[model samples]
Target: MKNKYSTLCYQFKQLLNTTLCCTALGMSSASLASTHSLLIAVDGLRGDGIENANTPHLDTLINGTWAAGYKAAFAHYAQTMTDAAPNSGPNHVGIMTGVTAKKSGVTGNGNVAGGNYSTYPHYLTLLEQSNSSLNTAYLVTWGTDMQITNTADLKIDANDAVNTQNAVNIIKGTYSASNWPQGTDIDALFIFLDDVDGAGHACCFTASDDGYVNEINDVDSQIGQLLAAIKARPNFTHEDWQIVVTSDHGGRGSSHGIHAADNYTIPFLVTSKVAKQGYLSGIPRNYDAAPTVLAHHGLAVPANMDGTVQGQNIRQENDKGIDHGLTTYLPFNSNYEDASGNHTHAQVGGGSPELRANGKFGTYVKINGKKEHLTLGKPSELDFGTDTDFTLMTWYRVSGDQVGDPVIVGNKNWVSGANRGTLLLANEGNGDDFGINIASSRSDRKDIDPIDYTFNGWWLLVASFDRQGVATLYAGSPSGELNIIAGDISNVGDINSELDWNIGQDGTGRYHYNLKADLDDFAVWRRAITLSEVRAIYNNGHGSELLSLMNASH
Candidate 1:
């Protein structure tokens, strides 16, 4: 009996070894060799739209590469009803330069010589090292990347289309698949789409939502053609042909911005021929990706880079907690239920919670949870002064299936009813059919359409209503702040003198009422705290005592 068992064990081990060998061999074929750049960009793809579309080709392809929703540093392209900055030229430059907008010293779209160039490691390392032998060229309009001077060395800048067709045409004339350069290893073929941006600015997402979406789908189809060409080649293993699709910055109505949600978070998608083998996984910050790409190309990452490289020495920084210089709500420690498991709140999936403190004293929860979280209610409220620059902070978790309204309560000066409170910002599941609604006492204020907040998982919601009388909402900390409407309302629309703002909603001011989600440390302030104050509050949430408790429980 013992001999028979030993023989069986040996057979199983042999099978496992053989399987590993086969798998490694396969990985080497698609990955070990150099990959050809088959990059594509689809404008205005909401982070929420990633999984819903019926586009199976894209769904599968996305799984093949490093994927993430990047943080848009400065979201310009402001709007009439905007609550943030309006022009995002400087933000775009950061992407091309592989640096933060602040570090790059770029705040708008301009080719000024002093353009911020805080060099991103991935762009330089990938081109200079891994694919060092390959020739790279780009075709993009004026915006995010102004560094593309007309060097004439395999580069095309479309400052004026058709009008400058002579110049652009000359560059593309060399792109004939049949007649390619034999000596030069053409590694990357980057393409940028800037038309939808115009639509967002002229029509606002309200009227141009369909147009914006259609434009993206159209670009996707065009990319499908490019993918087909790469696949038809002998050297290309379909998987060896790397396809990356992303935008330098997000868009909104009337203006671009840095502080808007749409402006801060950008889409990142990579589809390789060797998918199914499964690609890199886990939710990483936007900055982390540049380093990851650079590493894959066998290049060294710069230490000063603010982003991260996944699956490496770089760990996921918890900006949500105190350790990372944040304050406010408790660092979204971990998902928990009642000790007796009887609080009755549903389990949240596909999304997590983000924590933030108003460096002074308050919390902001960007609640996007699909299900309800049995959390602490608005047990407290304070007067966030009328003449002060105040900021609101909260840690919210977005539902994987929806972006629900779980925040937005009224104060002494809200709602028409003196005793009424409006808790807006919850999920209708179907779409933005629901939202968080807060009203002030006076009027002349523009109805702010929160620059597209995250509908997927979690992020810190930071509201900066400057004393200068403008409001801005940020995803994480005030890495960037946008301008929203912030003046006293004159009764016609101001609901400031309402009742106790409810989280689940009592059907007060907006379309959303019932909050099927959880909320924590919902706080207020008398004045808008400084950015550093916000960081301190974030840090406070994850106090040594609290972290130790969280870790022990985990």
Candidate 2:
């Protein structure tokens, strides 16, 4: 068995090397030749619409039973743009630009012309700017509602039938126009169909509606036609093709742009030789399409984009059991509610901590060093007996002004030779060190060497305790690097006390040290979490909520 220190070092080194290489090269080093992507956006296609309509092509693609010997597809009942109106312009911009309305400035269909498209343009435009040799095409059925066609070598605005036929002609290398008498090679293509949304707006938007179902069926047939055309290519065997199908938003009776699930839930599907079979690991957002497309072609996803590449770095089946022993989880997303379903909510005392909108994962609680703190009343589940293994972790951002010893989390008094519980402190015998103090009784306390702290930055602090009283502390930086310290505290037999559990100050109130920092994603587990699980939660500085980890594992 590999130790935690060596395993963490190896993982960090490998990740750092990959990051450096990708940064220096400006593109993925695994770029392949003759690769192509066909992204299809079917407007207002609900998750149930596919199941209710006759979509053999979609079924075959999703089930990995394509007669042409293609690999299985990755399907997801994904969510639309979050915290934005469920409108075509905003959702479409999110789908093509990998950003929400907050960044893209396309709040609705009427305001698309005034969007920030120049700064956060479509992925096709980025690709053209990065590599002009790669041919790109854009075909939309709703006229010029989409303003991202500037960089496409072939841009078309027509009805769904005309656009589908043009895409097929392009695939077969028989396309010609007034500007270019000869057809050009196509590498990436985006097709937008709006008839389904039109049908919904005309009448009702339900799976039971015949008009809506008929439009879906027609689109499925069009998709079938496109697939057949791809397989019919003369050099099909030599070309790698990826096909992505999704929708902007769903709707209710003749209307949308609401907060209801019917308007926000949509279907997302991806089929290719290298795609993952069956459903995606987690629920993806509409904005993830652009990054996914860019990553498929070995292009770099720009830092300005807000989307994450789907199906990348997914947790393996064996590692999905990370949440088995999770006892308490505090997300601190505008509240102190416990997300672990344990109901161990924290109570505010003294002055209420300010809830800030920006955090490592979500909203965080801001603590000013002046006596403000949160108290988690003594819960029996948190009291680990003599030899039970446990893990405690939290993400904190220091304000850089430190006075004396401050407690990040503790359940006992911090009196010398009288402590009786575990406390993770910001300073241990020194000003700029993070350490843990575990004690079963007065003389049984143990304080290990503290890890150096960097102020004005976010860091993940984790402490795992084994049945043998051996403790390991892990400090993770924003750069994906880790510093670990281990020590034997077997003399600290039962580090459980009757005092209440507190955050940002000592529980027993003996020490007036209050932590001046922002905190988020605090959790406790009955069993010690493995090193890989720690890395999964860390997620290379983009910390994940517990629910996301659970969903990925499932």
Candidate 3:
């Protein structure tokens, strides 16, 4: 029942995935051998704790100094489940099953029994189901933390020392027959260290706590032993191994399960020859671990999983076209400076918007609905006259339903009949839609059909107008699926206006339609970007690093 276009798109997506997998593995699809993955979960490991601890082994993994010479780990200050308590049970379910507490039905440590693990089994179980010949092992310090399905070939619940030893034994193919079937290869292994969490509960959870830091240091030593064993494998050179290290949650004052940053902020790290170097371009979550492991093995991530592949946001050759005609770019990475190098810096107009550390791409500006706005002061670069092709794009996430139709970005008064220039508005006409309004005058306005939008999530919105008076609107989901709608707007005359360019509100003195949302990566192009360029900027939900794309040779 599918159309030709849809079928072709699906085939293209599959081809792209295969190409990317082959490139990452440095082998053809048919030549790829059994890949291996080691997932290490350090309970209550804060992002700052890693910085404070004396962990040389972890440092090498983070900095990509391993014997295999893999790329630097994609280390990120990721968050736990935002909607659920920052506790072990919920977070572990997320890490193992790639689902949030809402879907897993495990809201806290006390009610892990209520989880839907059968429906949403661990990634290892999924892998086994896909390929029964593959072997997997799970070793954890806490017996009660057995959230994963009993599908792994070997499951060991013991103290940190025992678990670490068993992990090393399995990696070296020296595990006893009584512990694990001899000669069985572990394609996927998960190790959980709980002593750090115990140390946090015993005293303080901050990095200043000597006991907590020491416990982390001890875990690092265990990790080193496991890494050495992996390197000692006879076929280690032929095997593609990916090591992922992350934490369920952080703690504060010997307790956690709160919404505070100290409780939710944790570390997500991945070290592999195929992994992209340096930090992830976007905010990562604990749930991303499962899909990341699955993707490393060239397995398809289930559509039901909420997590996405991590550390694979490498720039492709198609991304080089993203910088074409780009005139203004606002990364909002702790600043409002234009990354496009046009010097079209933003100036604070009303109350200052807060610069949030965890944005979709680096830092983002949080705008309160109450009078907070930013202005570009009518830069000539943003002035697109009629017949001049232009494109406006931004990534935005609204906190919730707004009290009024909010203007996300515009360069006009936006008054009907007096409207000039183009603007992107959210919840226009009190509807659950994003509207793109392009007008030359009040009577010569053209409004594209509203596109449905979601709240409390990142989305990319693009409005491109061609000299032929054709306007195209694209709404991109976090997963890189784009919904497009286009209309002919040749009826409109000049869209150039003298009004100052404004973000999160209309630029005029009338502070109507103020946006209550987080905004990042706002940009403007002098010409309408191609559809492929739009996809490149979206970057499969990782979003593009504008400067990197701009500097890349086409």
Q: What is the C-alpha lDDT profile of model 2 across 1-554, one tens digit per residue?
A: 11222434534654465567777878553442268899999998875577667889888887777645465544324668855888899889889999999998888888777778888988898888878757788889886455653577778889999999999998876777743223455789999999999999988676557899899999999999999998897667667888888889877778888754457667777777677665454446678889888988998898999887875333123343767878888888778888887888888966668888878776888988888889887898789878777888999888675678888888878765366888888886557677878888867776644556677788898887754534657777775555454545555678778887888877675466777888888998887665567778887666777668877876
Q: What are the Cα lDDT values of the candidates?
A: 0.39, 0.76, 0.76
Give the per-residue lDDT of model 3 (tens digit) for 1-554: 11222434534654566678999978785555448999999998876567667889988887778866576445334667877988998898899999998898888877876788888888888888888657688888876677555578678899999889988888876675543544456789999999999999999776556899899899999999998898888767767889998999877678888664457667788888888766553457789999999999888998888888887763222244677678888999889998776899898877778998988778899998878989888878887776777888889887578767778888778666267877788776444577777788778776654555667778888887765534667677664445554545667788777888888877573656577888888899888775557767777667776666666745
**Which pairs clash inside model 3?**
417-442
Which scores greater on TM-score, model 1 or model 3?
3
Q: Report residue 500 deviation for candidate 2 (angstroms).
A: 25
- Ten residues in sequence with the least summed lDDT for candidate 3: 1-10
Name the regions of candidate 1 deviating beyond 4 angstroms.
1-32, 49-56, 63-88, 116-126, 129-132, 143-146, 149-153, 158-185, 206-208, 272-289, 310-554
What is the C-alpha lDDT profile of model 1 across 88-159, one tens digit per residue?
A: 444343334445555655454554346534244326334644433344656666544435332212555564
Clashing pairs in 2: none
* Candidate scoring better on TM-score of 1 and 2: 2
Off by over 4 Å in 3: 1-33, 314-554
What is residue 109's positional error in candidate 1, in angstroms?
0.9
* Number of the top lDDT candidate: 3
